[model samples]
Structure formats: C-alpha cells, structure tokens
Target chain A: MNTATAPAGPGRGPATHDIRNQIVVAATEHFSHYGYEKTTVSDLAKAIGFSKAYVYKFFESKQAIGEAICSNCLAQLEQEIGQALEGVEQPAERMRKLFKASTEAHQRLLSQDRKLYEIAQSAAAEHWPSVLAYEDRLRALLQHLLLQGRDSGDFERKTPLDEATDAIYLVLRPYLNPLLLPHSLDHNDQAPTLLCSLVLRSLSP
Target chain B: MNTATAPAGPGRGPATHDIRNQIVVAATEHFSHYGYEKTTVSDLAKAIGFSKAYVYKFFESKQAIGEAICSNCLAQLEQEIGQALEGVEQPAERMRKLFKASTEAHQRLLSQDRKLYEIAQSAAAEHWPSVLAYEDRLRALLQHLLLQGRDSGDFERKTPLDEATDAIYLVLRPYLNPLLLPHSLDHNDQAPTLLCSLVLRSLSP
Candidate 1:
C-alpha cells in the first residue's frame, strides 16, 4: 500500500510523515520503558492519540516497529563510526578509532537505557535479517581497512580477505558483544585498548 | 552426607557405590532421552527400581543431576584431548591435536544425540559453576601449550600469557561453541585445520 496516498486524519494537526515520526518516537519511549515483549500496539496508539488502525497503516506489526527502532539505532551507530574514521588514512589508526567508536556507542546505549540493549540482543538472538545486514556492512568496512593496510605494507596478506575478516570478527567478539563481556562495563577503558592491541599484532607485518 | 554407609537394596544387588553409579547412568539416559527439564527424580528412581528418597540421597536436585552429567561429559572430553596429545611433544603439533580432539569430541557429542546437545547448551547458558570450572581448566591447558610453544621457539611471546590465552579463546570460540559454529557440522575436517592454522599464524615467531 502506498502510504503517501493513504487517507489523512480529520484534524489538520500533523501530516502523515509527522504522524509516522511521532509514532516511532513514542514507540521508542514505550519500548525503552517497557520491554519489547510488554509493549503492545494498543498501548502505543493510546500514548500517541492515534487509532490502532492508523498505527497499523504505518507499521505492519509490533515486531516491524521494533525492527525500525533497531535499524535506526544501528545506522546511527555506523554513522558515528564513519564520522570518527573520517580523514584517518593509516589503517591501524583507522581501526583503533573504529573499534573505540563502536565500543563507546554500544556502551552508551547499554548505559543510557537497558531496554534498547535488550532490543539489540533480541535482534541478534532472533537473527533479524536487517541486523545480519548491518553485521555484513561492518565486516565489509573492516575488510576495506585491512586491504588499505595491506597496500600500505603495514599488514601481511597471509590469509584470504574473507577469512581475515572472519578472524577479526571472531577475535573481537568479546569486545563487540556486551552480553559476552559483562566485565567490560567495569573496565571499559582497558578492554578496547587490549583488544585493539591484539588485532593490530595479528595484522602486523 | 556420607553416602558410603547408605543401606543396600534387597536381593544380591550392587552396593551403595554401585547404586550411585547406577543412578548417574540411568539419569544420563533419562536426560538424553527426555531432556533436562522433563526428567525428574521420581522418574529416574522408577526407571532404576529405586525409591524417590533413594534417588534424592544420591543427588540433591534435578539441576544437581544435570550438573553431574555435564561435569562427567566435560571431564571425559578433557581426558580424550589429553590422550590425543600423549605422544606429541611439539607445541604446535600438540595445539593442533588438542583443538582437533576438542572439535571432534564436541561434534561427536552434538551429533550423537539431540537431547545431550540441548543439555550442554542449557548448562552453558545457565552458567553452572561446574561448567565454568571446566572452561577454566581448558583455558589453563591452552596456556600451558602456549608456554611450551614459546619455550621451544615455536611461538613468539609478544603478548602476556593471560592475554594470549584470551585471544586464543576468542579466535577459537566458533570452533569450540557448537551454537556459534552451526556450519561446522558439515565441514568438520576443514574447520579445525583452518582454525588451528589461523591460531598458529597469530602465534608465529
């Protein structure tokens, strides 16, 4: 269904785009306050002063809305990492900044609100296709950095690029996954540095 | 509670020690057939022709019985790995065999019975202290092998023993964790070799 041509509400208060944005914003709050399983479409619609039917018009289901929030959160995280790596030419320095940025973003999300972290955990555990796509994008980013390092004579090309990427991901799993590294919350500063050091050593010529 | 003095059953039956062994054997079968949650002390006793009180005399609870099974399985796995590396003196060769034995043992356990695998998954997920102890033993084994490699000039001592051990575990998580490496069932032979190669390369002098 073309959402753009969908019938507008009676009152001239907000446009359809504004309503969609409002729904997402309110849904985020609801999800953050109440866990993914607890929040319902009726509760979301009641909070936003919209009919349940109208909420359905914008999102197909509660899971779809949760996915939208997860997608947006991950996209924002990627953008932050990208912005951090801008103008960083050296592969090692680029990787350091990338990991630092990724860890800090996750730490912030984990500390700011636990429900958001729960949503991410659910996304990963449930194998949401969008989350997997985001992981692929992250892996591609690492591969690009590795290739640059190889070209600059900083890293040895001892293994295939794909295998190397997998290696990096596996090695950094503890640092990347909050669920796996609970102690990281206490030693946030040291964990990333140690992990980055190991990665760089593995890539060293 | 001193279990040695427990009274024997009627007839020319086995002693209390044998009865305890019988309970564990019967419990393993029950857990492997019906899973951890479904199997109960009463059912176990009924299967072995003993009273529920007698089963309780042997095990504290159902979770305790599950832990016993998990501990026994992990101990047997460690013994198998130790036996595999019996004649190998070289650090690199020993590591290769250790990993190969570990992967093959886990694969065997996973493929032999679905219920057994599920019990292991539950044990790990629940973080049974016995399972954690087993993991620490495995990590110590890896650290010992790494130290041997460094002493014999097979591997570089670029990183501290603890950090290197952590790195090895991180890199080998997929190979070691059946849940993480689902694709391993198909490529069992190549997976261990590929993982060992990456590990050895990372530790190359």
Candidate 2:
C-alpha cells in the first residue's frame, strides 16, 4: 500500500497506477451495465485485459473495487461543488450556483462515464455501507452550502438547517436520481439545461 | 372467473369471506414480521388455521398473493384520497387535504397491513410492474386534481400544470414511501404538513 513504491521499475513508471485506475473504471462500467447482482469479477478482469489474480492483488473483491470507484467519483463531485461555491458572496446567487453546478456535475458524469453513473445509482439503492457513508457525506456537504445560503439571507424562514437541507434534497431527488428521470429527458439534448431550470425554480427565494 | 358465482353455502356466508380476509390480514402481518422473502406460504396458511393447499386455491402463488394484496392496498388508498378530495374546494386546502389524506392512508396501511406495505416498498424499488402501474394510476389521479385546482384559480403558478404536478409528487413521494417512515411519525403527522407547506410555498405566485 506504499504509494511511493508503486512505480518502482523503469518501464512500469506510471503504468501500474494507470492499470489500477483502469480496473476500477472498468469495474464501475460493468456494475452499471449489469447491476450488482449480474456483474462478476472475472468478467471485469477480462474487460480490462488483466488476469484475475492481478486484479485481486490490487483490490480484494469486486465489491471492494466498486466501493473504491464510487468513493473516487463522489469525492470528485464533492470537490467540484466546493470549488464552485468559493467566490459567490450573495446567498441567492450561491444557492442558484449550487443547483446549477449539481446538474452540470451530474451531466458531465453522465456524458463522460454513463456506466459509472449508473453504478453509483445502483449502489445508492443498495444497503452497501460505503455507498450509504458517501451519501451521508454528500448530504452533509449540501447542508453546509444551504447553511451558507441561509446565513446570507437567501433562504426564507423555515425549519432548522438540517430540515431545510433535507427539503432541498427532497425537491431535487427525482432529477438527481438516475432511476427517476424520464428516459426521454435523460438522453435529450436539452436535458441538463431543462433539469437545472426546474431545480432552480424549486429553490427560488 | 365468473362474475356471478353463488355466494358460498348457508353456514359459510360471512365466515367464508371473513376467513379469506383473515388470511390476507394474517399474511400481511406475517410478511411484515418476517419480510417477504423470509415469510412462507405455509406459515401464512397455518397462521390462519388453513391448509397450504387451500391457500393456493385462494392464491395461485405467493407472488400472486402478494400482487393481489398490493393491488388491494393501493386501490384502497386511491379510494381514500378520492373521498378526501370531494368536500374540499380551495387549491391550497385541497393540496393540504391531499397530503394529510395520503399520509393517513399510508399510516393506516402500515398499521393494519405492515407486511403488505413492506412488500410494496421493496416492489417499488425493484420495479415491480404492479407497483409501477399503481404509481402511474396514482399520478394520473393527482394530475386530475391539479388540473381542477388550476381551473379553479386556487393555485398561483409560473410553471405548467404537468411540471407542477410532478413536483408535487416528488414532494409527497417521501410520505407515500412506507420504507422511509416505517417506525417514526404516523401517516397524518407533522412531517407531511411541514413538507406540504414548503411545496405550497414554492408553488405560490
């Protein structure tokens, strides 16, 4: 697990790291395509041109690989949202940006790595510990953004911060949810914009 | 399959219907207590003092019985909401009553038939056709109500009625979801009222 020891050879410089990332990416794709029950470790190894033993050396099991991929995807999403909220001063503008960024981030993921998005969706529904933990973390991040909005007078008088945060999530749940969005809308050219508008409308002060 | 089969025998009259109802009621209890996959058909039959074969005659399979029970539960819920909307007129009031009624109806089902509620929750997540059809029907019913409200000029709105309808459904989805509120508030409790208020706030002109 020593990070500095990973690319210890001349020819394998960065190749080892790339291989692991590729396996995680491929596993995510497979999980998304077939769902948890249908996906297999051997198939994932085959997809990435790695021996099953090689894959196992990097990750203990298929579920472990899935957990790591989801962890990485969600971490990147959370980081993007945090960065987007950095410069905005007004509460309402910040709230608006939060929603816009959410849709944009989601769209970027869906467009670039659709299978990974689906895997994340399936993981969210299942009772996996890692998935649930990541969701809790996401909820906390949104809560912080909402609290910031409230402090700036963007949100109206309402319940406490936690409740308000939950309300916001509730409103956007359908659109955030891969399973809930209309299939036509999911693939539509204008989906990201339309979805962002609808979400923003719900949050207007 | 005949629509006009003779009503059992002289002594069997209400007892026959009672026994059948009891079986379903007991099945619900068993399913709630043990969960759908864990509960057995024989356990249900035995709980109601009947043979497994007799239960099969009443229901072709466990899944068939589950489907029947789910339909019965949803139909009853639809009937309750339809009844609640009759004496209400104002748009806001109608929306309030709808939420209240939905909460109460879900609570009633949970209290009276927990197993069925749990089964339906799992089914809803798994894309059970019956549950999806039931949700579609419920959405249509809600749409009709929203259209009526629009015509009455009770609701102030910038969005189209269809989008508004979907938004309202999104808001109410948590309350209708037995999986989320299994142990906490009763159906007609404070959460629905609070959430509905937030939704109505968003919908106002």
lDDT of each: 0.75, 0.66
Put down candidate 2 lDDT per residue, A91-165, tens digits, no spaces.
Answer: 666666776676667667766765556566566555356656755776787787667766666655465666666
Candidate 1 vs. truth: CA RMSD?
Answer: 4.9
The 10 consecutive residues of candidate 1 chain A with the worst lDDT sum are A179-188
Question: Candidate 2: where is the Cα deviation over 4 Å?
Answer: A1-75, A83-97, A100-166, A173-199, A202-205, B1-22, B46-49, B107-116, B126-130, B156-158, B179-191
lDDT of 2 by residue, B83-201 (tens): 99887877788788888998888877777755556677666656667777877887787787777766776555567877766666656665676544452342225677767767766
Which CAPRI quality tier does the interface of model 2 achieve? incorrect
Residue pairs in candidate 1 whose N, alpha carbon or C atoms collide under 3 angstroms:
none
* Number of colliding residue pairs in each model: 0, 2
Most DockQ-accurate candidate: 1
TM-scores of chain A in all candidate models: 0.86, 0.68
CAPRI band of model 1? incorrect
**Candidate 1: true contacts recovered, fraction:** 0.08
